[model samples]
Target: MEILRGTVAANAKPTKPSFVSYVTPEEIKSESPRPYTPKTVKCPHLLPGEVMFCSANTVVKETQDDLSQRGVFGTLLCTNFRVSFVSDEEPTEDTTQLFKNKLYGQNDIPLSCVDHIYGGYEDKRKLITTGSLVKNKCPSKLIFHCKDLRVFTFVLTYSEEKDAKMIFQGIVHHCLEPKSLKNLFAFSYCENTACPEKQRKQRTMMFDCAEDWDLDMKRSRGVCRLVTENNNFELSPDLPQFFIVPTHVTEADMCQFHGKGLPMWCWSHHSGCALFKTSTLPLLPEDTIAQAYMEKMLTAVAHNYLFSVKTEDLSDTLPTVQDIQLAYSKFKHFFLIDNTTDFWMSDMKWFSSLDSCGWLDIIRQCLQKALEVVECLETENTNVLITEESGSDLCCVISSLVQLMLDPFYRTLPGFQSLVQKEWVAGGHNFLDRCNQLHLKDKENTSPVFLLFLECVWQLLHQHAPAFQFSETYLTVLSDSIHVPVFSTFLFNTHHHRATVLRAESPHSQRDPLNCPTVWDWSVQFDCRAQDLFLNPLYTEKPKHVKSVQRSRPTHQRQLSLPTACKTPPKKGFFKDEADSLKKMLRVKRISRWMLSPETPHPSSATREFYETWQRKPLDHHGLILPCLDGPSVRVWLQRYLRWIQEVQIFGGGAVTVLGKVSELQGEVRELQRRLERHGGSSFSSSNQQQQRAIRARTGTSTGPQTGGSRSSVRMSSSFPFTTLKHNWSYKPAIPTSVLQSLMASGNLADKEDDADPESIV
Candidate 1:
């Protein structure tokens, strides 16, 4: 019976099992988890008044290193403040970094900083201009070229179509198509930013008011007086509200040509000569009256303080604004590279490319022009009037260069900032138009005039390192800050424009934008640690005794009395013999009188004396400095142009190695001095005296060219061009033990076999 049941069970096993359903299909579908879809992620950090306009998720940021071809998954965002990318992966912070920017992060690019934007689709790229978003389809890739030579690329293939389109449109609209100056982020930021009064007081001089001008004049011992005729900007919108003019000129003279073609005082020299700048009169050859008046105005300028004036037409001497723009346009391409292949491909023809660009030629021309002006003031004892078409472009350039060369006050950090304010901002340079901050697409109005001036300054700083109190890093950072919208220093075209903007009401809020901070307020962008990079450690302060000596020197007094009238020659009448006898007597009297008069100093001897005095004086950083205008003397600014390129970064090498060693030696000496003070104060004082004597003795010898009492040494490795162990024995270890230990812990340092001898290792 059991065998029969088993057979039946086996035959019935193929029947399907019965089931009962408790849940409906619709309910199951609703309860189940949905597929993962990218969603908009809000930006974690925003400025005081920043507003996010659009965002796209699942974006990929392409790394600049073309060899790696790596991509970072992130979310791309567009706000009024900047274009930012937030990565999905947690960012690993480098604690070892000595300097860090607080205003902008690694993935952030300010809207004003965006020089050009390109969109790529199907292996083709096109510039994204105004209304391009409406004319073309949404691009899969967007590339940003910044004014600071930074390039950023973002891929939007993984993002939703609508989200991608929204972000692209948002960036183009806000970054390139602002309708008015009020729309800039500066006004909004100023509205919300609560700048401390103490901090504002400590910032650089703006030269925006009459008091600042007065203070500047007093500092320079200027003989000209400040005029407030343009208090309401009535004379000319381009001219400052308050400016210095010759004592001979009146308010009525300033009204001529809307304040154009009038000599305005820039600075005064110790030799009773002054530097002046003016705008060119309109090119109306047919208007003889205007030309005649211009001549008369210039003649009056020449008589200022009873000194002759030399007029330098910069438009005739230096490159035109258009020429500058063209040269810079071609020059910037070699550095704004997207891939390693292109960079290396262009490296072989670098010098030829640079020459063809004509940028260095422009720099040379500017330096030559400044040197000429310096000669006029220093040697010729004549006032120099630098004139250009607008007086805002090259006028600012040449005038600023002259001051930097002749005036020691302009070489320090604060003085440099003040010089920029006086020459560029207060001088009415069209920074808004030149920098294209509004992205107006007006090519004629855009030129890197300020950058050219900075380049010229860099040349001086490079040639005379110890003369400047600021480092090259400071200049590099300052150049980058020009595009940052938070600073009011480079925002407007003129003092009047800045004033108008500050008083105007913001569209976003009821607050006035009067408290906008300037770039000199470094606290807004950098912490104290980063701010230290702006100061040069090798700077030697100008001696106090030198200033006193300059002040004590008697001012040169010129002969102010009118010459004696000459008696008319005896008329040759009937008594011709008598007339000849009278002329003979007069000639003999003049000869006797000339012979009896006191002997005067020869002009050449006076010049030789001046040269000897200048040479004999101990080197003064604040004294006259001449630059080498030779071809080989002009060098590329490596720290600026190549800083962004990773391949050119020489880790633990270059001048930094020598600078580090010097810093260590300085610390050791300081420590020793402190110990000696604790042990024997008198011995420490004697040691200081001995050091001073040694320095004086070293400076007295004419062994080599000197700058600031010390020979100008080339900043390079002591064992340059060779890698022998004997030559490198004097150098400290390149990497510290602590750094090596950390690198090992991070698995970044590779282990190597000990193949060298123990003596060589030591």
Candidate 2:
């Protein structure tokens, strides 16, 4: 296209000029129009048939191509498509318009090209003038932040404030408004004004052709690779192709393998990391097969941006590492007198078990393994493939721990249970077989994987108590539900696994989705207790569009032993005396260690009388106790058990309630302290000033050479030419009653939805 300058149309009307143009003598003379001048004419530079919305008579400061303002002035004219400035000096007939009418020191900037507007000054209303102040200063600068984060500043003179505000708001409006499809196609009404119908038909035909071409090309491309996982052909010949993990399995990537394969689930980070849990080779022993399939899965990542990881060597695989973890668990289980053995154990025997079991050591090991898997996914950005002999044991342990660590949603009760459903119950962890083994005392098959995961979660909750809503009571009750079989975790395994178990138990039982129990049933059995433990009181759901807060690892502190004996509270709630008495008895049964004496002592009448009023099973008890067990031992357990009513109903501090309001209050205090530091006295002002100083320091010198001569003499803003534009633009439209009401209604509805399911991911 050839460049055009100040040349006028041959048929140009003798109307007044709306814009002040420097190249045209007629337009330049109009800038200083006489009292009886005719109405303003359209800007000469505007395209044919383009309309002018408005124009203002204001002085413009010429700027370098670097966007630095120069010591030059001109009259500015803004049209629909572009903003053009004319030289301040009156044009003479001898002055030649270079390259058509492209005048020296004139800028024609397209309205479509402006990208951003920055206004950082604080509200002027706050800066009030005290007694007898003649005038108040207001910030009059606005910097436009545009493509490539480049900046240009503008300043409005006090006299032209009204015009400056209008132009500023208009430019911003043009920048934000979505461009119409017609604009994108460069179709204009003027192009077909002479034959409107014919032009419309041609435009429509062109659009139709483009649409058909795009459709055909897309159809030929087939489904996007992102949604499919069958790209890689690598698999073991003996194994089914479907058994291997998919190459790219994001959290949003759904499964298409009939609910098997244990597809890897990637988080939406650019780190190319993923997590998957798969069953070990059923026909091969753990030591015999190398986890080369894992490496193969990872190899696909180079092409697909997927990630997969496996333990480095066979020696460090789940079977060997978890074997050592389970050994420690067995050692503790062998000594501890749980509910099954509680009826038979003497006081001395119980004490000996508690003292010798070293349960804390097991807890430590469980925590370490969980942390290792978490670190892999988070810190190292490594993908992980966790597999065990049956996939239900240690594999379940690792998968659940990793999800809980990374997905903050699982920190709440419903989220926790959804994770259980997705990861354990639905993922095919053999809850039935494992719980059965524990019940039957089958040492070999019984793994402490579930317990290990719970302990790991406990460590996190214990440290970063504010980050989670559910208390330790929730975890304790959840663990208890496993033994209680009626809970869904124990009742339902995978569809095939559950179906098999049900078929054997009752051949005619219906196996429909409706017949299966949901995890919500926990509320049905113990509504009050479930509500207390299952929902977090501290959790505040953020809007769905809000970016999630980055989670930080809980600080590690030296693990503390369980308090040996409960000390009576100096002051308490209304039921303080009852609470202390019950706590004292509970602590004795839970943590006290007695010397092993052969003597069997008789119970006191007072203790016997106290025990008679309580008969129900203890909520926190893991050990089974026969009804025939002696009264004193039973009394100690029952008094604390009865206190659950007082605790739950009155004080809300049952034995199961681990972390109390004191810690929650502390967290709030810390948050307030941070806010204080952030907004204290002069700190906020000082910080804001520091940022302003930094921005000003980077601004180029405002004075530069005059307008273009040769290309080498012209300085551009980086590689692109830019003309600095002004600040102090304000646009505040009055809110309509209908719009205000609608906004309020929508906000209220969102709050209601949030309240309905407080634990849900917002």
TM-score to native of every candidate shown: 0.76, 0.36
Off by over 4 Å in 1: 1-42, 92-97, 198-203, 283-286, 506-513, 544-619, 668-762
Clashing pairs in 1: none
lDDT by residue (tens digit), candidate 1, 538-559: 6666545655765676642211
lDDT of 2 by residue, 90-115 (tens): 43212322111121122444443333
TM-score of 2: 0.36
**Best candidate (score: TM-score):** 1
Q: lDDT values of the candidates?
A: 0.71, 0.37
Native RMSD of candidate 2 (Å): 32.0
How many backbone overlaps does candidate 1 show? 0
Model 1 RMSD, rounded to 1 decimal: 14.0
